[model samples]
Target: MNFFSKETKTALQAKEAALQLAFAPVAFQATRALRNLGILKIISDAGRAGISLEDIVAQLTLSKYAVRVLLEAGLGIELLLVNDKKYTLSKMGYFIEYDELTRINMDFTQDICYRGMDHLEEALITGKPAGLRELGPWETIYPGLSLLPPDIGKSWFDFDHYYSDIAYPQVLPVVFASKPRQLLELGGNTGKWALACTGYDPDVQVTILDLPGQMGIATQKIKAAGLEHRVSFFTTDVLNENLPFPDGKFDAIWMSQFLDCFSEAQIIAILQRCMASLADGGRIYILEPFWDRQVFKSAAYCLQQTSLYFTAMANGNSQMYHSDDLIACITAAGLTVISQNDQMGMSYTLLQCVIK
Candidate 1:
């Protein structure tokens, strides 16, 4: 009766993969070294003919000894193929070298997660963003976004927008369907959605609600676009139970990649406050990458790992939710799920809800 079953003829391969996981940290460092030293590029340029270790050393300006060690590691990791003493990039290596998603994930991991992930155990125990202290003294990561090192901040924002920006197009039409006059962008990081909204319709006024630090960045970006007259910012931390939702009964509220940053109880509270503030007939548009809703196993795997970032560096108690759990929150908050738009770019799911 079990619907799930798979052949175990690949059992040996599974064990080998598990072994790879055990040495993954070192393998990751080696791959990073390969990328930074242009070893991958050299091997890739060599193409199917491959490049000898000496040639790799000559091209990358590295010592022969370093080249041998890194190349052997890459071979073991399957990032390189060695034949007749020449090395070539594997298919995986090609993606690591040129894929935009791979670049974003690598940069995000190195800049935002590497050190912080070490504190994951402590974060889990305390139910707080313990690793955020690595970046600053702030209790949470949001307030310190503006203070992060320039390169790290760039990686962080790149990872953030890369996913949401792609979904904006699909969501914009659904949001403006009723032709909302006043739209509230909850947790509008860097004012991307707000800018898009105002640009889509000059008549639609946009107000952003986020932490003061984030609002500062959002305000600058909105002003730079010369849409300041149509867009505004309100400072508030949703985690603060006392900070009620904006009094502005906006005709629409947009929360993209926002609710996943909080625990279920916090999500319920936020939704309730949103329902109270939302005007009659207005809808709350929720954009999230629900792992359980992902069609590809690789996408689900990636999202499952991203949840750890929440545990270690972001808020400790939140994660990439399952669609079922999110729907539960909506229902518990006295809201209706009018429809769910799936297949959004980057495996995102948009849930459109209105007050019950």
Candidate 2:
């Protein structure tokens, strides 16, 4: 509040940042482990039963004392309750069950980030991933991803594909005035966005382009959506493969969460390819995370650092870019920025560019 003077505000912000710096990692690990324990209990109880401490010990293969400690801590955190020698999820814990956002966050922390955090020191030193330094990075992570059964990592992509699809109805009108045929959805997993877009415009032909494994999933999803007639899937490494389509083959291109994965040069290259592949004045819409200069010192900075750290660990490279950076990339690739809007109020920017 303005009632707090500027000096007080600055001091409070610094204090809060210090607290976050100290508490976030510990709290993150604790909550994630607790949530996993709760889920384990839920599943063990036929999905409708409460679990006793003994059950937790058996499921987690922990000593009785350790189980008690976990349960006590969990109860204190409101993830669990102590009642009649049994533990049950609290109402707040229901967010883990009922909210996709909560589940995705838990998954991200547990499956990807926790281990990556173990390598944070090495990452900071080399500006590369310690996990990759030891494990060969992208190659190891991607191929083994499908092999791992349905947990957070596998489910994350589903949410990614699904929520991006969910976002389309709201984003389309702002991004597109009239429908265009021949849509290319860059890095679209399982063709969700293509399906949504083609659903809105029956005449639109859609191609979903992504990595081979991702395209495999997209193919099945697109086929199941009954848009097979209008939609097709293409498995191509956008960075390595030559732009397969002829110049001006696409009327519109959609790249959601695609640019954030690349280095700056690669971003420029991809934008150039989009420019060449698009029809005259054809629009390209990009939805990617943003970290403007104004946000460089805000809580967004912490979020961005965490995102960057995980991305680097998982893939050896990732960057949170600003709208201006994107605009410059678009212009460098012979495209002009039409307009940009922050979607969902700064979660991401809906950026539109056209061939110059």
Candidate lDDT scores, in order, read: 0.87, 0.65
Per-residue lDDT over 1-356 for candidate 2, one digit per residue giving the tens place of the 0 to 100 score: 02223454487888977876677666666666666555434533533357776766776666788667666766656666655676667777667556676676566656655666677676657656666443333542454444445664565565355434556767777655756778888877656677677767768888777767666666888767777788877766777745454356887898887787676677888787777778766889887656662333543554466455445465555566665776677778777777777653335567788776
Best lDDT among the predictions, by candidate number = 1
TM-score of model number 1: 0.96
**How many clashing pairs in candidate 2?**
1
Off by over 4 Å in 2: 1-26, 39-64, 71-99, 124-127, 132-148, 241-246, 292-306, 309-311, 344-346
**Which residue pairs collide in model 1, if any?**
none
Worst 10 residues of 2 by lDDT: 1-10
Clashes of each: 0, 1
Model 1, range 65-178, lDDT digits (tens) per residue? 998999999999889998899899989999989899988998999889889988999999999988888888887788888888899999999998998899888888888989
Give the TM-scores of the predictions, in the order they appear.
0.96, 0.75
